[model samples]
Structures are given as C-alpha cells and as structure tokens.
Target: MNLTYLPLFYDLSSREQRDALNELMARNPAIQLIDNILEQIQELVRVLFPSETIGEENLKQRVEVYLQNVDLATYGTWVYYPWLEKIVHLLNEEDFIRVRTSRNMYKIDQKEIATLGKKKIGVLGLSVGQSVALTLAMERTCGEIRLADFDHVELSNMNRLRCSITDLGINKAILAARQIAELDPYIKVRCYTDGATEDNLDDLLLVGGKLDLLVEECDGINMKILSRLKAKEFQIPVLMDTNDSGMLDMERFDLEPDRPILHGRLKVLEGLSSIAIAEQLRNLSFPEKIKYLSEMIGIENVSDAMKRSLPEMNKTIVGWPQLASSVMLGGAMITDVARRVLLGQLQSSGRFFVEFADLINDDPDKDFCRS
Candidate 1:
C-alpha cells in the first residue's frame, strides 16, 4: 500500500516530456482554469511544461487561449490516488450531484437523491456485504459509509465478490473502502479491520454517533444478533439480505423498538447474550462452525448443493457455495430497501423473499417448458 505518485520526467527525453505535458494539459481542463484564475498560467506551464524552443510569451498566449472557455468555479483542486496516481478534477457540489446521479432519472427524484446522499450507513461483513456497500455507493444513497470485516480476500471469495485475482489476500473491508474511494471520492469511508466484536462494537455502532442504518451480513451469529440489539437500543433501523432465495430482513427498531430480533426465528437465541453465545460455540471445531452456520442461516434457505456439502466440509470441501448472481442481486436489493427506509417511504418489519420460484411457479408457460 504505497500511497504516493511520483512522475519521473527525468527518465524521458525532452521531446517526450513535452509531449507528456501536452497530453496532461489536454486531459485536464480544470488545471488550466485554475492557472488562468490565479493569473499564473504562463509561470505554471513553464514550471511543468518547460521547453527550450517555446518562449515564455508564446507559452503564456497558448495557455490563455486554451483557458478562455474553462469555468474556474465549477471545479476545485485536482486529486490523485496515492497508489494509482490517476489525477481527477474535483467537481462542485451542484455539478457533482448532477453528473454522478444523471442516470437515476425519474425513479429517484433530485430531492430524494440529495437527502439520501447526506445519510450515514454502516455495513458489516464484506463477502456479500461488499455488493451491498458498492451498490449503495453507486446509487449515491449514502455520503458516509463504515465497513467492518476482519477476513482477507481469499481465492474462494471470487465466486460471488466482484474483484480481480490481484486483490487476493487484501483485507475485505479495505478492499471495499478502496473500491468505494475510487468510485466516488466524495463518499467518506471508514473501515474496522478487526471486525465487529465487544472491543470495537461501540465504535462501529454508536461511538461516532449512531449510524442511520446498519446492514449486518457477517458469518458470526453473535454479531448478527448483537448488532440488532444495539440497533434496537439506539432506535436505528437495520437491514440484511441473505443471498439464497433473495431472503431480505428489515428490522425497523425506530418504528417498533420492541420487535424481536430476527423476528424470533431462532428460538435458541431468544435469551442468549452474545458472550453466552460465543462461549457455547467456543469449543466447536472449524467444521462444526460451518455446519452450525448452515443451521443458523436456515438449512432450507440455502441451495441444495450448499446444504449437501455442509457435511463434507471437514472431509472434502472448505466452505459453502455462493453464486455471483445471488451476491449481486443481494447488493442491488439491499441498496433499494436502504434507500426506501432512509427516505421514510417504508416502515415495515419482517422478512421478504425475492425468490424466482414464485415467478417461475406462476408462469403460464411453465407447462410448455416442462413438456
């Protein structure tokens, strides 16, 4: 993680350096406007685009002409990522609002987009949570987002997560943060590298002020319940999406503070504290945890292959199966629900499954396909 960009002009021939400078200027009209506004266009060009044959007077005239149509106030300072070194012109808030969300159109009105952009969101677990986090950023739904995941990117995660091979072994939380940074620099990103636990749960949930919403998708059953407890305590809404069968759970503690966590689905978790739950599973072997996870997520909710493979974990396979389609769909659906919840248009508290079975089972052409 080197975060520095140093252009080595000394390595290039004078002609090549000049050509590079010309290319840079051609690509960034924002810098030209900045130079013109400061009345240092000539000096700036001379400093950065030095040439033996081109006189100072000639350079000044050329730069001044190039900046005639450039709008100085429409953009601010140029920024480049330390690692990638790609320069980007910062846009004014109004211009940014228009350009970043131009495709949202009539679906999300400008007022709603503006409102959503100011809200803060938190996402736990980066495997499937990565999609949800990125989707939220894509919609410009939340201006500030916090991500928590202690796991590193493994080759196995590529099945559902959208990342290249180069991302292997990187911290999932940081990977998500970096991707979000590259997508929208205006979005403030925070990551808890250690994942959510008693040590950092407060910071993640309440210390920096309660998050507008929490999206919990971690493998830790305790976190799944504990996070909801905290959300309920703070009267903050929480949303989660289990990729299988498009099962989505919305717990609007703000609307119904007394609502049972997970709609009281797992009776075993009714009165258990997170510490007690952790102690109960502390002695379980790795394979046992996998099998326990299958049960925790509801064995019936998973694909047949995943359910079948659970028993094979210690003897054959390493983990469960996940599909790119389900992960991506979880991302899109969670973001949609997050927006609705944030905008106060939805206040329901229950489970909703966006499964294809309903559609496929009801299809009038089903008999034709079967025949």
Candidate 2:
C-alpha cells in the first residue's frame, strides 16, 4: 500500500485498506490471481498514467511493490439482489463510483455533478421510463433513485426497451434498479414493484427526504395527473417524456406550488375524481383519448404522427406505437432537463418539441442541393 501512489485510500489505516483490497480481490479473481497480476497492473498503469508510458518491467516492479505491502481481507461481499433472486459480491461504493464515473468529469463539472449526486429522483414508469432511469444512473446524475413500476417485462417490451430475453417477466422497477446497480453500485436505488399509487404515493414522494424531482412516465392517465398533484403539493418538479414525437413536458411545482396540472389541460378534468378520470381515460375511444392528449400537450404542438396514431389504437394496433429511437431520445432529453432543473438552471417549465421533422426542416443554416 503506497500511500503516495493511491492517495484516495490514504485516509484508511493499513489494516482497513488491506481489508478493502482483499475484499475487492476476492470477488475479482483477475486481480487476485498471481498469473494475471501483471496484466492487471499494466491496465491500471495505463489508466492512471495515460500520458507517461511505463514499460512492462517498470509496471511489474510497481505492481509487485504495491501488492507486497498491501495485504487486505475480503475483496468483495455478496449483496442480495432481491429482484433477481440472487446474491452477488460487489465492489465498494467509493471505488466503484470513482472509476466508473471518472470520465464524466469537466463536462458534467464538479459543481453540478455534486448537486446531482445529492438529489434524490423518482421514476414512476419503467417502459420508456426505464431509459430515463438508466440514463440518469449512467450519467451519475443522482446518488439515490426511487423506481416505481408495477409492470413486468413482457415479450413486447423488448422491442423498445434495452433488455434481454433472459429478463422477461421480471418487474420493470427491479430490472431498472439491477441495471443501475451494475453500472454504479454506489447509487442508492429503491424499487417499488407495486408501482406508485394512492397507497404508496406519500411514501414514494416523502420517504428519505421529499424527492428533489419526480420523472412521471407512467401509462396510467390518472396516475400522471395524480402524481403531478402530489408533486405540486410537495413542491417537487416533475418531468415527463411522452416518447411520442419527442415531447417533453415539465412542471416546475417547486417554483410555483400552485402551477396548474398538465398546464391546465382539459379544464373538464378539474373536478373529476382520480377514480373518475381513470375510468374515463380507460374507456375513452381512440379519438377521445387523442382529444385528452391534445389538451395535455396542446393541440397545436402535437405531432401529426401522434394525432394519426389515435385512430389506429385498439384497432389495427393494440396500442400506440413506441420506437426505440423515440424512447432513447426521451431518456436523454428528460435526463438533461432533469439535470438542469435539479440544479436550478432551468427556471420555467412548459412543453418542448425536439421532433426531428421540424428540426431538420427549419434548419436556418442548411442549403439544399437539388439533384
């Protein structure tokens, strides 16, 4: 253990550092195996000192010296991944976060990155929401995340979701959390397999400090409005990406606690009970649902494709079309907006359209060459 070489672990006593190293090595055989030590050292040296080339002889000398003085116990310990019904040994949190997110520096910056790590964000749906949740984790945008998705992964979900066939039937929330754990075990992920509802809304929003922001991507129409209602009550900002025509809806309830829900869409929905709203949306014809959706995002801003899909819903198609492109775009879009919103950089909220059609068509700097 050369304290000078690994300054980050200098705070720990020799015994503690040895224990951490041993624990880490135990789980990672490549690090523990004598035959692989040189290779490991070479890789580490490359990553640590990319600009300075240390030859194999020098690398071995460095690694041997470091290993000789470093005697730690328990390289890793098993963590029960309840969702997958398995226990697995994982790397310690600090080491994991450090190495995994080391490349995200300067671009994310220290100030906003620090702010993001302290914020606890909640994701209510895991279909397209899974993309948002995982993107958030991948970016190290939040230290703790609450995922609430009742649906299990089905065959159809694989079309748009970044999941394998082996994961079919697992709860979406748990799946998302497991993926997050794999990416950054340091991130605190809490899953609600039952999904966010009236019974658990309070716990989801207020538990472990009221959520800094809530990303509502649930399919339940009533839950969408209801979650916003609760978010407004608690003064938490909400971000939702429709995954249709690149629509991103933002509600800055934290800024204006009394801000109208869905931007005051469908005023007829004002007095309707949640149960009534749910029932209405559930049974509405495709045209009716489109009408409601139009109100939510504003009819003028709605995409032509989105408007056209309503007629086919429950007819030629069992549900509206969802593309992997749109879903992934939604994830990136919402995560960026969520990051800005969480950092208080984005002060106002409204609907934003990032549709490819409009963007390329209206490009002011583009010149078309007619063939």
Candidate 3:
C-alpha cells in the first residue's frame, strides 16, 4: 500500500497529533484516510515479521484495497524522514530495513550495489570467512551463499568471528547458514556442514548448489590443497586470502588457464595428498617461516592458539600468522580484492600482496615469472 511514515510516528508524540489526524480525516473531503491505514498495516508487518519464517501473500489483497484509495507521496522521502531516522537510532533495530531518498538530492548518484536477486556465492572456512559472509549479507550482495567448513565455531574464535557465544559449539558451515538467514530473511543460504572434499564438493555447488565466486578462506593446508586444485581442474577462478605478517596475499587460480604458465613452487597446490601438503609446509625454512608468522600474528601463543585443532603439521602455517601478530591486515586485503572483483575491474595479474603496516598496494598487473 502507498504510505509514508509521518502520521504514525507523529501519532506517538502528542495526543494532539493522533487526535488532529483523526479529526482531519473525519472532516477532509479531498484527502482520504487510506494513507493512514496503509502506514498502520506496514507497521504491523514490520513488528510481526518472524525470523527464519515466511510471510503469507494473503495480506496483499487487504493492503491493495487501502492502496488503491490513496495517492503515494510525490517525493520518495518526506517530513517523516527525520522522524523515522530518529526512531531507528533510538530503537537500535534493523528488522524493518528500508532505504530512503529525497527528491532534492537526486544529483548524487552512488554506484549501484549489485542486485543479488537470485545470485549465489560460495564460502570456505568461517573464521574470517564468516565475517565475509556477514558483510555480504549486510550488503545484500547475493541471493544465496553456500558456506562450507568442517570446523565448529569455538570459544577462542569469538573475538574475530561473526558467531555469538551461543554459536560456539555449532558446525561452522551450518552455523554460518543460520547466521545469514537470521541477518536477512530474504537471502537464501545453505551449508556443507561436512568437510568440502574431492567427492562431494562439486555437488554442494551445482544448480541447487552454490555456483558463484568461490571464496577460499580456510586455514588448513589440506583444505587449501583440495580447494585450489579442484578449482583449477574445474576451470573456475579460485580466490585465496592468506594472512601473512600483517598483510594479505590475494591469489586467483586459473589466471590464464588456456595458456597456463608454469610456476614450479605452486606445484605445492597440484593434487597433493593431505600428508604431502603438510610435509611440504613443514620442510619450509623454519627460522624464516617462523619469523614471518610471528610478525603476522604478533603474539607468542602459538601453542595456545592451536586449540583450533589444526593439522599435526599445522604449526608450519600457524607460524605464518595465527599468533605471531595481533593485527587484521589480512581482512583489509581481502576487502580490497573483493571490491575489485565485484566491480569487474579486477587487476589483470592473478595474485597480490598487500602489507598493511607498510601500506603497500601492489598492482596485480605485471607479468609474473613462469619459473
């Protein structure tokens, strides 16, 4: 129904406001009270809307009855704008999310947010990955998102993860799905509550699956080895955000798949067995690797942080940042890459390293060595 918020909020402040509205409706011959009815109905919808619940179409007929008798405001916004803003801030709620615009301020056209009417995104890991999913939901970037992770949100992860303390024991993927739905009912979310493996991975991302940009945020060597190789074989772009020494390393697989260049080192990702990947990581130069990891995480609690139940050789990568540094450079770099990719303006180069402390934003455009 066509309505504006002015009359309803005013109905709250002074008895004079509500009484005036009723008296005016009773006496006025030109302006119908239909607008008031529509406002009340919308308010009811906002109040009664349930979480993980669907609304019936039954109310539309009744709403249409009032709408047809009324005239919508010529301007998208009106005197009620400030009042509604006040209520939202005062009430500190967002269940009834709506955006407003003013007729006079039409000159400024912001870049349109992606209309995620029914699009999808697939996410791996729910550490930083959970935060990424929540941000995407908040922006309404995808109609559906498939969250894949075998881990559970644990007590130690509460500070940086999006889950609540209540969600501490839930499987990450399932918990992430619930979180997304709770954040925005309109979004369709699913989960691969089990580990994303070589066999069931593709099934989890087919038609009834998530087939959008795949986000690789898992922190395990096996998870990453499978993810990258699978994406390469499938000819899909796989993006990885690695937290290293107060920086983020962003890489996209299959950069030039048709004319694939060679980098022998990246063979670390080519169909390696879980044990092989672990051994390869362990064989890295320990002193240098540990130093780099220490710088990234900024702490001396490598053992304490390992409560995350990582690989037997997980210490290889853990030194990369899990506890050596206490910064969030990794998240910032991930955000930058996401922006460029979404804009269809991703750099030609497939990998980038961003150092937050140094503030270096390297162009991911130059030719990389073939090795």
Candidate 4:
C-alpha cells in the first residue's frame, strides 16, 4: 500500500488556502475532523505563564489575553494526514514547540532547547532505532531525523519492534517516519529505504548537510564497518547499542579522527580500503562473520546468556534472541547519551553498561528486608 507520512498544513487566515481546505473537505465527506486548537492555546497560555495560578475560567482569560484581537478560529493552523483521512487543528510551529517542550524547563532549559532544535541526527537501523527515534521526538531532542533501513517489518520482529500487525511487510524506515509524523508533524524526517551502503552512505551522511551524530544499528557486518568508516571520514560521532546486557558504544570520531573504529578491536582490517573491507567480509562464511562480529563487540564483555546463545544460531534458535525489555533499555540509553553528546555534557568515548542484574541481585536466598 502506498502511503504518505507528511501532513498538509492550512492557515485559515489565508483565504485561498482556507477555501481549498473547505473544497477538499466537501469532496471527501468521510474525512474525520478534529478541532482542539482552543484547548491547545489554553495549554500554551499555562506554559507561557508558569508563575500565574490559573483556574479553568482564568485560563481562558489568559488565552484571550495572549491572542489579543486574533479570532479563536484562525489563531492556529489546521493539519491533514492523508493516510488516516483525518484533519486536526494545532498551534503553528513556534508556539507548538514552546508548549510541547514546556515541561523540560529546568532540565533542558530554554537555551538548550533552542540549541537542540537546530541539530540533525541520522539513525541507521529501525529495530532498536525505532524506540530511540520515538524517544527523541517525544523529548524534542532534535529538529531533523534521518532513518535508513532496507528491511520490512515481520511477525517475528514484533518481539522487540514497536509496530502493529498491519505494519508487517512495510519498510521499517517508512513505518518509523509515519509513527513520528503522527506524534509531531513538525519534526523533519528522511528515509533511506535502500539501507546504508558504500554507494549511498555519502548521501545519507552528507547530502543535505553533515549529520551532527550517527546511530548505527543495522545487522550486516559490512554495513557496521562501512558506516563507521564514512562517519570517521566526515568526522561525525557514532553511537550504537548491542541490545544485550545494556551495552552501549560511543565512538567520538568527531573529536578523535584518529580513533580506530570499534576501539581498534578490528585492527586486522585496519589498512584495507572500504571496498576491500566490504568484499572480505562478504566472502567470509557464517562462522567467520560471527568471529568478526565478536571482535567488533568484545566477545568477553557480552552476557553469559548471549555467549551461550551465539553457538545455537540457526540451530536451536533461528537467530540471536532480543527481548523487548532490552530493546527499550537500549532506546533510553542511546537517547540520553545522544542528548548529552550533542549538548556538550558528555565527551569521553568508550563502551558502557547499565545492566539491571547488577542493580537488582537475583539470589534466591537473599534477605528481602535488608535496608
């Protein structure tokens, strides 16, 4: 099914555009109309005047004061989503962002919010990346997000992916873009359905403008290496989540251009060109590929469960297992680290862990009431 994720906007104050909206609605009688601009304006007023104590009556008065002489009907813009056959009213971009991120007051202050609004992020996969993208959108961490994935949703992917059954067979990147549009239509999203490869990696990382940061999560070993090579070439920092034991990887290519990829663990392929590396990895057998992957993410550092599961791939299990809980944790960790890196709060680059087992012991006979 062909679908468009971007929403159309109409400014009621403009007679021509308003007439077009009316004409379109008249033609499509089944289109669902949603008008909550007034309530949104009320929320905006509350956010604007945090110090003022406002009840329902005073809130409306505050909205009127902020609107001045502007009519309630034309104060904001109307947005239409083609895929859902629905139309909604929302505040224009500026005020919409202001009220949406109002709760982040002291934590991400006004100055940091503005700074983050101008940053762009590129995500290379959609499984765990889906959660990361959604969290970033909900926090309004960046103004633009780019997604790249060559795979489609599958029934098995539901174990960890945040998608409906109907989304099966849809490209992962496109599905993520639609979800983000529904959440906040103002954020910019670009998709690379062909996935990241040597040919298109440049376009993905440098086309419109160089991305401020890159998040690599694809399954291909070749892509895992190629993407980092390109990121290092452009001096863009990279982040990744291994989806096991809360393992997170951050490579500050931007800060240390000389830093070897994957902390120099794959030093065996150090001198090879990108093409040579791709060809060599492609020729490797299944076991060889796993050997290289182990090098990429320290084999010794992975959980004991993962270590046992690796030998069972295509045997007892079709593939390495991933849990929804671990994926959610990875999303949260990556999003937090991304914000810190972009905002200049975190600088060092290395592997880190936020394992739950460490925080909550699983001993069967441990005292439960110990303080």
Q: Tell me, by TM-score, which candidate is best.
A: 4
Q: For model 4, how does the per-residue alpha-carbon lDDT over 202-296 read when each residue is reduced to its tens digit? A: 99998888999999998888899989989999999999998897999999999999999999999889889877888887757789889888899
3 versus 4: better TM-score goes to? 4
Query: Which clashing pairs does model 1 show?
Result: none
* Model 3 residue 163 lDDT score: 55
Q: Give the runs in model 4 whose Cα sits over 4 Å from its true position.
A: 363-371
* TM-score to native of every candidate shown: 0.76, 0.79, 0.54, 0.95
**Ranking under TM-score, best-scoring first?**
4, 2, 1, 3
Compute the lDDT of residue 183 as modeled in candidate 2. 62
Badly placed stretches (over 4 Å) of model 3 are 1-118, 249-255, 258-264, 268-336, 360-371
* Clash count for each candidate, listed in order shown: 0, 8, 9, 0
Taken over the whole model, the C-alpha lDDT of each candidate is 0.75, 0.75, 0.50, 0.89
Full ranking by lDDT: 4, 2, 1, 3
Worst 10 residues of 3 by lDDT: 83-92
lDDT value, residue 257 of candidate 1: 90
Worst 10 residues of 1 by lDDT: 3-12
TM-score: which is higher, 1 or 2? 2
How large an RMSD does model 4 have? 2.0
Model 2 spans with C-alpha error above 4 angstroms: 1-68, 72-91, 271-289, 361-365, 368-371
lDDT string for model 1 (314-351, tens) is: 67876556778888989999999999999999989888
- Better model by lDDT: candidate 2 vs candidate 3: 2
